[model samples]
Target: MTRALVIVDIQNDYFPGGAFPLVEPEAAAANAAEVLGAFRAAGEPVVHIQHVSADPEATFMRRGSHGDEIHELVAPAAGEIVLQKAHPNSFLGTHLESTLRDLGADEVVVLGMMSSMCVDATVRAASDLGFDVTVVHDACAAPDLEFGGTSIPGGAVHAAFMAALSDSYATVVPAARLAQTH
Candidate 1:
């Protein structure tokens, strides 16, 4: 099966000293970089999805800002595709679906920042679009969230989202498993 690696929103804003930092962001980026290397070595298609917020009131990921750029460790190569998006779903308001289609990608290996939001949205959307998806759990990160005065740790939030997606929206695996697959 033809497969593509979709690296979503591994931007500066999610890292340390950026606008919005996620839990274990550096470690997650390293994991993603490792997976990216595997895909590159295997001659697979790799697409980088960048989130550029259009809202003027957005605190992070403001368009044209330094934090809006993808992190250097996992930045796209010259021939690789870089897609800018304004929504949680990468396929929405972007050429992600068409690009995948053109690359003959029936399966996608996904990883990146904000697991509870972008990763969750993209995996479900990919499933709805009829593409098989494999989400690298360790390669994704999320920040702690608060709801009704209760604080949810980032790790818990990440695990919950991965668990929800597993066996339903996508097969959630680790970076090592991804290497094995390649």
Candidate 2:
């Protein structure tokens, strides 16, 4: 079975000094880049998913904004697929499903920013689409969340989401472990 890598929303807006910053984004990006290199070296298909918000009041990822641009860390190189999406679920209204199918990929390794949002959404969607999904836990990050006036730390949020997705949605592993195999 063919395998592909789907990088979701590793944009400037999630990094420091951008619209909405996440915790340890640089570290996450670095690990994600390592995974990208692994896929490239193996000559596997890669899909870079860029999210652009249609919401006018959106704080980040607005069209034509530098913050909305995919960051240089794992920027797309020639021949790598780059797709723009408008939703947290990368496959929604995008060519993601067809692209993976066209590449004959039965498995997809995912890693990206905002672990609780895009990463979680895309992993579940990919699984529902009948693809084997593996998410690099260390290559993902999450933001602090608030609920019922209670604030959750980013690290805790990241851990919680990763835990939630580990067995049900995808087999979650750290970038280091993936590096050894790739």
Top-scoring candidate (lDDT): 1
TM-scores of all models? 0.98, 0.97
Q: At residue 137, what lDDT does model 1 achieve?
A: 97
Q: For candidate 1, what is the lDDT? A: 0.95
Candidate 1 is scored at a TM of 0.98
Over 21-118, each residue of candidate 1 has an lDDT whose tens digit, in order, gives: 99999999999999999999999999999999988899999998999999998989989999999999999999999999999999999999899999
TM-score of 2: 0.97
Candidate 2, residue 94: the lDDT equals 94
At residue 147, give the lDDT of candidate 2.
98
Candidate 2 regions off by >4 Å? none
Error of 1 at 149 (Å): 1.3
Q: Tens-digit lDDT track for model 2 on 39-91?
A: 89989899999999878888899998999999999999998999999888999
